[model samples]
Target chain A: MSAVEHAVVDQLGTAEARALLMTAEFGRLAFIDGHGPTVEPFAFALEDTAEDTAIVIAVGTGSGARAAVGQTVAFEVDEIDPVRRTGWSVVAVGTLHGAPATVTARPEPWPDPDGELVLLRLPAERLTGRRLRRETRRAGRR
Target chain B: MSAVEHAVVDQLGTAEARALLMTAEFGRLAFIDGHGPTVEPFAFALEDTAEDTAIVIAVGTGSGARAAVGQTVAFEVDEIDPVRRTGWSVVAVGTLHGAPATVTARPEPWPDPDGELVLLRLPAERLTGRRLRRETRRAGRR
Candidate 1:
């Protein structure tokens, strides 16, 4: 009998999703640029407060991420093992905004001696995640 | 007395960007779902022809990728070293469509015994990439 591999996907709750997000240092930010929809990687930090959790990123003055402010965007983080074909992904959707003075923790700006930088924050308004698992089964098995 | 690290970002040509893309096994797909803009990772294979190059991904029936058909999307692949804080990222923007019969090579779908799978293709219409390097300088040194 031949064996076939199957994938099982499970949905994680908000707490689990946020927990997973903390394990990753960087994530892809999806938003609409002048050309169209685009995704870029950004190093981010999580800002937790009694009110809400926010994704914070620091971008240089000329960075496109500056335009993303005031727009709804999705920040996604994941850890996957391509060899094992197993991993988990978490997506946080919310409106991007200028970081307020009260936000103490901010993502470190990349070394940019001449370029000014700004902080953008995205509160985790809607969080969702999925875990992928693989199992091998004999094709003839019931 | 102290040193500062700065990031230098370089833009890569189309040919070089495509070369870097070939080194990665998977990428993140950014598209707009009913909820809003979102991104998810997928295993992808590059379909190179005399005419053009396409990114092929196989998804199950329940995959949100199904709704991405006919929409403009961005596929990003990157290799980053968090510890060193340096890496390269490539973004391929294109329109998504159902894979054609003429297409021979396709991405492998995750094992899903109970779900039917379909193939989707995104031709690399506009490709852009950036390489980030770090340089450390003594304080107040040019």
Candidate 2:
């Protein structure tokens, strides 16, 4: 936490959210598993096709997401500075599938690189984001 | 990404996961909305009561998490250094509810001030984590 004691939280627009998502290297994918709602972080890249833009992630063949194909999932990515308490988070929700697009070749999982990996894609149907702004007030400083 | 090109990823035990959770000041709470799955980040603290270990987060009444009461949710927190491409992430899944335990008064949201805030609790039934380790190799220095 910084000496900054004030913050402003603002909701971002769709285009802004998409732009932010493109800047992130990894994000968490929330999907239903045998236990229930589960979230796992994965390195991802944005894929653009003729029809739409999708968030593509690579995971090991044994990863749980393989069972969640066709399910509606939420993908979230954010950059927050713990000390400054300022950052933005963007979330995209849509259907998850196994079809690998041309862009999928670019995203490789940081872990399990040597293992058998598969590409999972989520259509960016709904995207939303929020920005947190932090400011510090110095004493005797106008 | 760090100059270190090689890395190792390891699965963490429950105790290690919980310990990591305690070290982070904020995490993303994944919950369901009428549309579908959604995720939002919030500053949180781990609360240990007589009954069980609960994750406490404070949000304004207008926050979506208020609707998460009685719903099973997944809470995730992680710290990853993009430069080093290494970090650890922990996820806790449980049912959400409204109970201002002794730990409730401690956590304060960054944007929302006092008076309008409400404490939402999640009893962590399942906790898991993973760590990424990066190592750098020099020519003839292996």
Candidate 3:
């Protein structure tokens, strides 16, 4: 769609990208339903050794992430500054599967689960990223 | 991780969230890495029909989106006011798969090759979202 290009520029290479994934802790997950597509933001944990993999934070008896039990999935992680209008974004896609309920509930799902909890198996299929750079739109009819 | 907590609140029960997947338009994909997190805006085509429960937006080959072959990814869709710190975000998680090299060879990736392009996928897990009602520290501290 025309909108994507207008929003970003100068994408990064694979290595630069994986580095970003390793340190980040939260992002968004999207799903499609009968009405349309739904996108939601959530927290995730990545394997300490792997740079581009993630584990969704569990939220209650696997009931939270059960929605993506057998569906393809995608996520977006980025940092933005509302004041300057500058930031970068990375996109991820993969299949999401629940981690199967833990035999006995651990009362708390997250290390700090005031209440929210969720878990997911994110396997990346493709990885793409871009950097933020200012460029004037080409001369054209507005 | 704290930043993501707010994101989870907005999408918890919002089935009416926006991001016209079937409109054949583009949106933003946000991700995290060493640079914290980033956002890239791009365009895409809704590859399937409205009936397809799993919203699949095909990213043609050779485009930056193709880089998403096997990496953790997220997509960010928001409305821009350019003056206020008020905007919402929706993210999806998944990996990009091979749809045939021909698909990647499309003339343009996002409406334009030189423009930024972000990709997204629907998550299989239950959707949980948080909204930033006010700029305040997360309750009870994580």
Which candidate ranks first by lDDT, i.e. highest? 1
Candidate 3: list runs displaced more than 4 Å: A1-8, A48-52, A60-65, A82-85, A100-118, A135-142, B1-142
Angstrom error at residue A56, model 2 = 0.8
Candidate achieving higher TM-score, 1 or 3: 1
- In candidate 3, what are the lDDT values of residues A29-77, reduced to their tens digit? 5555442344554556654323445445555432234565566666666
Candidate 1 lDDT, A16-107, residue by residue in tens: 99999999888888988898888778888999999899999888865688898899999999888889989998999999999998887768
All candidates' lDDT scores? 0.86, 0.82, 0.46
Clashing pairs in 1: A6-B111, A7-B111, A111-B6, A111-B7
Clashes found in each candidate (C-alpha, N, C closer than 3 A):
4, 0, 88
Cα lDDT, model 2, residue A12 = 95
> Between which residue pairs do clashes occur in model 2?
none
DockQ each candidate and list the results: 0.63, 0.55, 0.10
Ranking by TM-score: 1, 2, 3
lDDT of 3 by residue, B1-142 (tens): 3443321133334453433233324455433334323344554343333323222344433344455545455544544222232345434444444444323222234423343333334332322233333244555554
Off by over 4 Å in 1: A1-5, A111-114, A136-142, B1-4, B111-114, B138-142
State the displacement of the C-alpha of residue A64, model 1, in Å, after optimal TM-score superposition: 0.5
Number of the top DockQ candidate: 1
- Where is the poorest 10-residue window by lDDT in model 2 chain A? A133-142
